[model samples]
Target: MPRHFRALAVQPKWHAHDFTSAAAFKAWMRSQLEMARPHLTTNQPNLVVLTELNGLPLVLRGGRWATPLGTFQRVAAALFVGRLARTLPLMWREGVSPIRALQLADADANTRLYLHTCRDLAREYGVYLCCGSAPTPRYSLVGGQPRRAPGTLTNQTVILDPQGQLIGVADKVYLTPDEEAGGVDLTPGDLSELRVFPTPVGDLGVAISLDAFRPEVIGRLEEQGCTVLLQPDANGAPWTAKEGLPPDPANLRDQPVAWLESSWTASTRGRSIRYAVNPMVVGNLLDLTFDGQSAITGRAEDAPEPRSYALTSPRPGFLALTPWVTTGTPEHLRRAGRERAAGSGHPLENEYRTDVIWADLTLPATALTPPARTAHEEALSAILGGQASRNPSRVAPGLLAGLGILAYLSWRGLRKR
Candidate 1:
């Protein structure tokens, strides 16, 4: 069998429920991370890239907290702040305190702390945890400021090793006007350099979601000698399982192989860049997209054309590869962090656009080439405890089985009442 590493690309969705309160957001994050962990361990890919806005809180306001939330909260109800306020008293009276309400008062404190812990957990599990689709730049004209493209403080991507230790951070440098169209004052980050780090497997490049849409980010990664690109993003209408996608719970139509191919070729044809098409993988809780149809693509230096594959079974496992050279930082991130820490928002003054194009990367099973299974597989297999003996149809067969049972009981009580 060919040596194949699996990448668990994750797109963690934070809906209104996720941000209603700090606790909710944190709990949601923990749950998502836990769910994604199994896949990460089983499919120890070269790298695990998350393509969602996990690092930052989408704040909003209302409830007893009476706090203003993150900009993402604005994306929730189309209604304005005034409208959300009207319903606040009702929620407070009825003892309804959403997670977003708590986030507004203490945004970074808990968020950063949670992220720090999450990174550690990821490292402990031996899965590379990468966060993307965080806050980026925005087109804003707040506080009588000039209508320039300013660095809007949004979400950020966090990187962790198998032990979930903090490896690096990637701040998004692009933002779409529509994302910030209903502005409560937003800005954009600089068009910074791509950030790469050395992993036990190979050099990995991580860029913001929108940044990947541009040839520059991918080219820069290749220039930096990256063998894999891990992109974690939350995008578009919920995905469907057609056209090559794994089964989408949302039941939306999909364009699988084409989706997978677009990500694989992101940086393959850029100027001053001469790396063969590095297999780009995208991950989310429910989906895994690979560029080459099969997991086993030829060596990085010699991949076959029109790459495709076929698989007889659904083989999702934890994977890992050898590590390579890791070094360097994005000048903008350092400068911005320093500037923000020093209370000088000078870096926030710039005009730029972050347009991210997501390509679906679901290939047909037959087109999939299985990667080599190593001790890494055995390690994850041990962790999973090989519960295949049970019926796979039972969704919450693990620890969550208890929660499912509890929910069932609660429902029975409510119906009786």
Candidate 2:
């Protein structure tokens, strides 16, 4: 029998104030789903997809002073001061930089607030939920509870069944420059560990943010017979901004056009993957700004040639695309800032301008059979059963204690200055 389902790509505009507490974050997430409720059908399976780094804001949880800050640097500084006791020790114990340590300090809280909330929401809506990626250490389920496993932090995405049980996780295989050593310092996941999770809707494969740009990542999943590709994204640059000239400089294109070539165009042009959902996280996190038009792309039998959209020129295979309030140029951004400072708010700054783009998709009949578990899946299953051993640390305890003391003294001296 042919299976049909509704897939929703949720474009969320995040604000610093939303991460003030776990309750606030969950409430905000619930409201996003509420907006999609009317479009969902009771007769068919539903898949709810969120954007990448949507859960990254939860690192500000419990840090009241940092939640209101306007820039990433300021927020990080305030968070370090407010959670000094916890972050300091983690930095020394993990032998990682301050930013990485802070992420580690809040890893458990992030996991609980993010996954548990998604779990509850999935159960409430009876939808398969893909809780987007977060910058956190690997965690394994022990005794039916999530426990932090010893590992470097990476961008990880989790999928849940309609009953809210965890189906699997896919960590990002490619790391952008910012995610490398000098920035957030996240570790890259091995591409060999990718898994295709089978659901009533389709065989879903997640290729997070930059990972989607890589042909190998998409090819591996296609080889596994994945019918639906979820590309959750949070572009660090403006959507309208023109990137540097490519190898063929004559074909100048904006970020959206380039992204489309790698995503929608790639998936639809003679590919077996039936559908691709790309959800984007927009809005500002101080100096860091994320902006992109969330979209759903697929191949339709009777569909006409693709037409031009707001940001991109004539492009095919787009099923649905969200609209943005502004063009996001430097001048437009400056004007928006001036308007906010003068007590008149710009529509671009409205965090409540959330959108959910949905498309009804038909799946191939062969997509129902679940594939055999790969080796990575077997290891994940063992970890869920609490049979996996914790990784041992090589650093001496006394050396770590000394480093902690030194870091504390440096922090105190900087404050004194």
Candidate 3:
């Protein structure tokens, strides 16, 4: 079997109630897997990547806690500054405190279910898989259960092997301003410590969503002999809009920004970047819509432009990328990680469902295309995780705006209630 093989991106139409029961969740996943199973060829190591926090709905099955009460509270809090004054009494009489609702939902059972589901999928499909990302507690696997060390939960990515072995977990290092206030109440990962796991496909590294935006995180991973960047994302917004709160969740169409950014980013960051899987969270949960523009992106050294391909449906669909290794000996490929971007060539195959989109992205991986680093580049990369935006001067200003937004959201009204 050739070392290079096909990779499947699983995009599911996840509902708020799917996580209520493990059986239901697994059933949903199985259906999607069955759809993609037809494309999985034999004698090749198959890789499956999902979006970020795709399993979070399991914990959200908790009653009113899963309601838009969180969103209501957030916006109301933001506007009123500490006075749910009118809303509090209304909620009190209605009988469910948004605060209590938020507390009631826990990832304990959800986490276990998530692990079991991914393991089963890997074992069943006989393919390597990333259970996508989840907002799991700051945890360590002691024995078999995931245990936290008394810190805020971290947005996590669980990597699994074809044999169903647990490889490594990558955490979301950078949280958006909105994430800080509401969302998962996530605690960012230590930027200095990155997780790159050894996979059947060379050394595999994962950057959950925004982590790819910084040059530092992906830069260091590339520096560490890591290839096959598995990015499980949950960016809930239209493609064209660069930044800010997303619009209404009712729109049934998806934009192309997810793949667009990743494509250009791969060119700038030096690697074939892929997996901008829209954290497709669909349902009646706080005005958030994770549309299905899940994409597979990469760049070929010979090609003038980077490749960006994704689904257009807002429902369920996926992008298939057939990985191509350089026409060289095993030893050459092994050391390729240190010298150049892993899988520097083009994608041999790019296929998808929904609309049945297909493309040929094959390129020979021969030379090193790693960009030279400068003093300012080094310092900035260290600060930011990946290259999200090209404007270096805007970095400090972006940080300031984020800080200001965070401070505004931290107002008393938005706090917990």
TM-scores, all candidates, are 0.47, 0.82, 0.61
lDDT to native, each model: 0.37, 0.71, 0.49
Predicted structure with the largest TM-score when compared to the true one: 2
Best-first order by TM-score = 2, 3, 1
Lowest summed lDDT window (length 10), candidate 1: 317-326
The best candidate by lDDT is: 2
Q: Which of the two candidates, 1 or 3, achieves a greater lDDT against the reference?
A: 3
After superposition, the stretches of candidate 2 with alpha carbons farther than 4 Å from their true spots are 141-147, 244-253, 300-302, 326-353, 367-417
Instruction: Order the candidates by lDDT, highest first.
Output: 2, 3, 1
lDDT of 2: 0.71
What tens digits encode model 2's per-residue C-alpha lDDT throughout 1-417? 788899998888777778767778989789878978988988899999988988877777766565456667567655655566667777667676767766787676566567667877888988998888888666555665555665478888888788877787889988876677666668899898887877877789999987887789888988888788999898776555666433344676666667876558546763668888899887766666677778888774423456433455555677887765555655664454334321234553434236899988887666445656544334344443332223311112233445555655644444343
Better structure of 1 and 2 per TM-score: 2
> Which is better, 1 or 2, measured by lDDT?
2
